[model samples]
Target: MSLSPSTFETIVPSRYITFTFPNHHHHHHHHLRVAVLDSPSAATAAASTAAIWVPPGRESDWIFSTFSGHLQLLLTQPLSRLILIGNSPSSPQPISYNSSLHPSSPTPLQRNLAPLLSALTPKSAFLDDGEIPEVPLLVFEDEVVKSSIVEICEGPCVGEMLIENVELENDGVKEFRRRLRFKRMPNFVQSQMRICPKNVTSFENLDNMKFELDRGVLVQPYLNPMVAGISVISRFLEGRTFRPKALCLGVGGGALLGFLRVQLNFEVVGVEEDEVVLEVAKRYFGLEDDELIHLFAEDGIEYVQNLAKNLSEECRFDAIMVDLDSSDVSVGACAPPTEFVRKSVLLAVRAILHEEGVVVTNTIPSSKLLYERLICEFREVFEELYEIDAGNGENFVLIATKSKVRNALEANEGAFLNKLKSVVSGSYIDSIRKIPRTADPAF
Candidate 1:
């Protein structure tokens, strides 16, 4: 029963749901979207689990830094319904009885939250043993999710449920207010906030990493994968007769933002949705709100979508480097990576890409299913694709380019290598050299 690829259709229906903390005046787009094809899909699960904080508290820091402690799934992976169990008006309304994700329904997903209390309750001494647990806030079709201020921790991410002790507060409302607390090491905090070079011990490198306000820019080695992705892009551009225009997504620490502007001299634009993040970048990362590097506080997906729909051809880039981190180096791939690397986003990338241009993304290949899906989706959009392994294969840099150099198309291997050498030199030179100039498909 072999079926033709063109004739085949997806049997598994997919669901795309978005969640976020309530919006503020300056940051209105505070939403995170997750797409789930089915349970057990690594990429889908990763994206859904990307951002759940235990609320920031001084007491929560000890548990987060512990070697190993309690762990639990924040939300159901392949999330069908988002339940906020609370009396608050801002909470999402419960899902109707007929909806597929309803826990009371006779569906496989109904079993997801059967033991909700036990699953969310982490074994920690901070909790009161006699305190009865009640559903304070549940925002979903099935039930209400209790609302709690999650503290961002800094340490290991065991993926285990280790909640700090819960203190049930009597808000004098009809139902008891459940102030839940959970914690995990903030995954990309250091990568985004700190500027460290490869050789941190050397005094000269340390000095180079320092940033003073309104002066020279700062960068971090945490962006090694992006560095590699950009190098591959530069090599491709150098083989051609045209210059490179670069775009960077996620201005968390402005590592790539600084590198592209100062080192490579590419006309660069950095897009970040978080004003708080952008403010931090300006204050700490030596990033200035200036004309040379255009900074936009908007969602990357919607930004690119609008750029393609509204903007003219002249606004496109020769090189686009996206660092909306798709994986936790310690845990594996997550949903944001899935969102960023999906067919739609990749196609949007292709829409704005120069016929001779390239786009690169940061990912972790440690997760087999996520890694394979990434390569597969990338190939669906670009003419040629390449990857560079970083941190001894911990991080994977995906380079997808619609354009190919004349030498490469003509099978002139030696000339192609020479051109790559010329485009990249210094610290970046060694990393790009580690990856073969050709794809594994070339075999």
Candidate 2:
């Protein structure tokens, strides 16, 4: 038999409840359940309330069933009421009635499910156990107009009723179909994933590719080319002049190190995982004929471990710059585990940095938690910390020094900005001067 869309609705006394729906699409009445919570609370209470939604099925049921069970388990007490709406025989009304009567009363379920619910639905206001619950009316519609439940307020049948039902030709299905059509186009493919180095080369030879200083590469405070580019150069200069050796981890395209070599004339040993990127840089990024630029095709972490084991005090680098992937964006839009930031990569950074040397890294500015953890870790090892903005929604650089340095920018701010202005050929230096000296707490 062909499965047809059907809508079912009901009402229960408890503030929390779940309704299951049969999945006829797969020749089975898959139990789909939705749980409604009046408030938010801890896990224990939410779990007790969610237990009611589990039907006589194993853990590997339909998608909806599994989600409902997980949601049930996550809801704790002190949460508000829960309303489970689904196509099952036991599904409840999509909307709850008389929820505003206990304005000050707290529903444990609502509190616990607030974050997930907020992501799925519109914002809501609820009263604390001692506060007021902000309840609003909502409409419901589904495929196949079979049944509905309306919550009635005061005055018998004359009060406001919450309506939940399905339509024979569901509007949702039409929208989905429309979206799928757009997804079939070629341009849409580019939006899904970033262009890789090979594709970039295929589109245009690396030598032919022109680097422009567009808004994508420039932003406020970092507009001063000298400040943005030279600070890096000056840091290296300080290390090279004083200690005379440096190492870089995850050097992509060698643009950063190349800039340092050309502008500041500093020799840098760079390790890159992708030989293609290194080759492209050498060919196109003015890296050719620069003996100061040394390229290594090795994993950055492994390189650090080897350096630690093989390098003596005299052979150790005076400074190290790391620009590894902190998230999918840096790693070509691939989501990495949190451990990548917390342990593996961080340990590698520490292993390579000299005893009294400096280590600089590029990381997203919005990741306050990660930034805090990094700062905490550095505090245990380094004597000073500094950060600089690179602008244009790009990453910020964190500089940790083992020795006392007045400031990373030092006296090179003006000269560096002037140099960058010469290279990018823009008046961005004026805007860069306005950036507050204080580092953003979020970074």
Full-model lDDT for every candidate: 0.44, 0.40
TM-score of 1: 0.50
Alpha-carbon deviation at 295 in model 2, angstroms: 1.0
lDDT of 1 at 338: 58
- Residue-level lDDT of model 1, residues 1-443, one tens digit each, is 43233221122212222223222222453332111121223343221222222221211232222211111122233431222211112222111111122233232322233343222222221136655333223322212122222222221222322111111223432121111111232222323322223334533211133222222332233355555454444445555554467788777657667766765666788897666556555644567667678899888877888887876777788878777754332232332455676677777878888777777776644357656666777777777776555543345566777765333322323443344344333344354422233444211
TM-scores of the candidates in the order shown: 0.50, 0.42
Residue 400's C-alpha lDDT in candidate 1? Answer: 74
Lowest summed lDDT over 10 consecutive residues: which window, candidate 2?
Answer: 175-184
Show model 2 residue runs off by greater than 4 Å: 1-245, 283-290, 326-356, 407-440
Per-residue lDDT over 292-393 for candidate 2, one digit per residue giving the tens place of the 0 to 100 score? 777887777677777767756654665676655532221121112244355555555556556556666555433466566666665665566665555544
